[model samples]
Target: MTDKQSKAREYVLADLVDATNEVDDAMNLLTEARYPVPAALTAHLQAAREQLAAALTIAKQGDAYRPRCAHQCPNHAHTCDRTPTHLSDHRDQQQKGTHTCSWPNEPDHITIRISGGSDDLVEVEGCEGADEFNCWGIGLTGWRGDLIGGTDTETLRIYAIYNGIWTFAATASDESLPMPDWPIRITDHPDVGHSALVEIDAPAGTRLTNVTALGGDR
Candidate 1:
């Protein structure tokens, strides 16, 4: 994720914390207030607090939800002493110039895991193998995972690079797809020339849990 994206996430996470703290502080102030406070105004405060509580519950669902590590340290001989959050995406290690969790070097045949997070409209694109934009000679190239009930809908899409054209491969939304869709294969499709790109569009209310996406068969 970019620094801007990370900062946006930080603010998102801070919402619940800030809301709860505000309520607590308000209650404390109310208790210490020497002057008479109107019951009507207090009722409004109580209502606002209730709304914040509800919002927090909804936010917490996405807050606890996040995309897990896309890849782990392929170098088992060398432990990835870095934190889990750092290894969640290969790009992070790549930018840091660390090999602790070098997953980007080998993005093909990789599996994706969806754990928890908001349906914050996330989009990512990547190519597999030596060729820059083709799925040829590559195994499966998609993500397969389950969802936690947080929104009305969620969708996963795939596009194949056939003759330099991004063509639609397949799509699944909510429970439309079953468990273990092993690989998003393009080997059968003759048009798949060089590489394939998988894109996921998650809205604000989405919560995917217990997810896994592998480029090759498990």
Candidate 2:
């Protein structure tokens, strides 16, 4: 995430915390009020609080979820540490050109692989009930494709390269709507070639679902 995006997320989290606190205060006041508070109003306020709390929890959990290191450090004899704090310090050292062997370099090849099917399509596990997903690839000859949702049957055409990485990402406001059917097609792009391999990324705790897609169909 860019610095701007990080700041935006922080702002949103702050807002959610404030909203939750306000709701708590209202509920407390109602409990202490001399007059009886309407039961319907109290229930509505409680529901809103629950939703905000759930959203806050989810926001805090993701944005850092990823597979464990694929390579081990020669010096430390352990996999690279990708914790937020360690990664931040490691990045700073790299920029300063004083990096050491704290973290091992990422493998040139993809650590997690999506088994490809006919027509260059692949099934990305852990996508059922996901509100958003990010697809990235290394050694990709083609950079454009479409993502078809399994349950909702929605198709998202994507083409982009972020920070020099071939990437395509999407989000849905309706969290209830599950996106991406099990096997999503990677349309052939003769202009560039085709996808060699891909890594599918969904938010942490996303449920896994399997489905079949032939030539980008159900």
Candidate 3:
């Protein structure tokens, strides 16, 4: 590679390494607390640390070479300053290893247009099964540049059957959309549960290339 290209690659690599290492150190500090730490905080720390690690891996594998992203980025075509996450192999083999559902072997084949889900939405069948779809969550592609995942980080309210069809709300970090692509169980979220249907009201003209669902817990 030319000197300029080499410098660019080094810069990208440094960014990746710094991000991953910072998370690792923070997690260590939190976990090595002198006093008791809240389980919730600890859990969040670990997840962040893992995400950074994964991003580092992808960068090492040359994600910088991907098509130039329209958004601001130091490297050519790279989207997020940090590694954009996807379902990991372990996660795929065992949807967080917390629960299971009749999840498709892959994302939905047919493109689904989310015009508020009344008529133009897709559903994961067999979710009616008790205990199935425990960490019920849905996501689509193109929420991020070309990535098939959620929009900016967000929290969402969903209807699920705990005893009867009930409403549950969940949140994700970092500008994540209400319904992030990550697996999130809909119970004991920061909301009141009431008998209602899962509501999906995305902005107008939002088209989803594919839909994915699986069982997991927050």
Candidate 4:
């Protein structure tokens, strides 16, 4: 993986953590508010919880194979940069392979386009802003991006034209992917003149793959 990709992954992991926290907060708020849990709200809460759990699981797996630097160099030492070659040595000694994803030690943005539709193509905009210092909370607010924010006016939008849609519980590559426990909500913005196209039907054989960066310094 390039530096940009690594940074984007790190930013996504941090956002996952934030999403987990946000879901917890939302659940607590719902309970404290004494609002009767509507079926839809309850379902949404549950789905968010599960997504957060899955994200953490994936993150832990990535962390398990991630390489770490042991030797500390002087502040002025060029070797302290931790290049892929240096990390490769560490990974080899640790019995870890060299296929790990790590790069992009800076803040930037990226877009994920979902294509291969028979009729129309769907494009989702996602941010990938991460600093080189490992600071948290940069881009991709949640696993679904900024698609859940609530406002009097809609900000996010999605629509699907496919006959069938496939939803994966965890990873899309899994054979026995569990069905989505909650409905996927898509919204549109009239003031900003923006829209999002999302697939919701499960039996449509929808396949989700490929994530790309939009545009940035990286």
* Model 1 clash tally, residue pairs: 16
Worst 10 residues of 3 by lDDT: 138-147
Model 2 TM-score (2 dp): 0.34
* Model 4: per-residue Cα lDDT over 94-141, one tens digit each: 223343323222232122232212212233323232111111122222
- Following a full C-alpha superposition, what root-mean-square deviation does model 1 have from the true structure? 18.0
RMSD of 3: 18.9
Candidate lDDT scores, in order, read: 0.35, 0.38, 0.32, 0.34
RMSD of each: 18.0, 15.7, 18.9, 17.6
Index of the highest-TM-score prediction: 4
Measured with C-alpha atoms, the lDDT of residue 155 in candidate 4 is 22
lDDT of 4 at 181: 22
The stretch of ten residues in a row with the least summed lDDT in candidate 4 is 129-138
Q: Write the per-residue lDDT of candidate 2 for residues 1-218, one digit (tens) a residue.
A: 55644554465556557766877888899889999789987885675565455545644643322222334223222324355655642311222222244434443211222323323334343343322223232212112234434333444333222222122222232455554322222222233332223344322233333222111232
- Model 3 agreement with the true structure over 1-218: per-residue lDDT tens digits: 34643454465456546655665676788777898888976775565454434444544554223222223211111113323353221211222322233333343322221111211122232111112122332211001111123333333322211212222222232334433443322112133322222222232222322122222332
| TM-scores of the models, in the order given | 0.27, 0.34, 0.31, 0.35
Better of 1 and 4 by TM-score: 4
How well does candidate 1 match the true structure in TM-score terms?
0.27
* Model 4 ranges with Cα > 4 A deviation: 63-218
List candidate 3 stretches off by more than 4 Å: 1-5, 66-218
